[model samples]
Target: MKNILLACSAGMSTSLLVSKMKEAAEEKGMEVNIWAVSQDKAPSEMEKADVLLIGPQMRFMKAKFSKTAEEVGIPLDVIDPVAYGRVDGEAVLNKALELMGE
Candidate 1:
């Protein structure tokens, strides 16, 4: 199963998106473990994630987390603002899959 991690300022904003993404994954018959954490908790969480997608509002943290992501050997990217704004879970899930070279 793929482990997808979403990191935002407080970790609360992504909860809805996570539910949407889970629905999308179920539709696609994909088995994934997805969760969200605050920026402060993301570094430790990264080690368990297959890919990391940061919230649009927390895009600035990407640079700070890139080094850790590199060390963890996982792909990291900022969520698309449009999709994020709309809470488009399928798009975010697809982005994560693409990052994993799926």
Candidate 2:
């Protein structure tokens, strides 16, 4: 299963998005492990993920997260505000897969 992790300022906001992404993956018959975490907890859990996604609120930290992702050997991307605002899980999931070169 692909492990996709979403990081947000507090982790609460992304919980809903995680649900949406999970649903989307299920619809496409994709087996994926998706979860959300507060930015503070990300680095510690980074190694467990196949891909990392940062929420818009924490967009400014992309540079930092990018470096960490590289060190951990995972693709990291910021979720598109438009897709995120609408909770478009499929779009985000596709982006993660694309970043993973799948």
Cα-based TM-score, every candidate: 0.99, 0.96
Please tell me which predicted candidate would have the highest TM-score against the true structure.
Answer: 1
- Across residues 1-102, which tens digit of lDDT does each residue of candidate 1 receive? 999999999999999999999999999999999999999999999999999999999999999999999999999999999999899999999999999999
Compared with the true structure, all predictions reach lDDT values of 0.98, 0.92
RMSD of each: 0.4, 0.7
* lDDT score, candidate 2, position 23: 95
Lowest lDDT block of 10, candidate 2: 61-70
Per-residue CA lDDT of candidate 2, range 4-46, in tens?
9999999999998899999999999999999999999998788
**What TM-score would you give candidate 2 relative to the actual structure?**
0.96
The global Cα lDDT (0 to 1) of model 1 is 0.98
Q: In every candidate, how many clashes are there?
A: 0, 0
Off by over 4 Å in 1: none
Model 2, 67: alpha-carbon shift in Å? 1.8
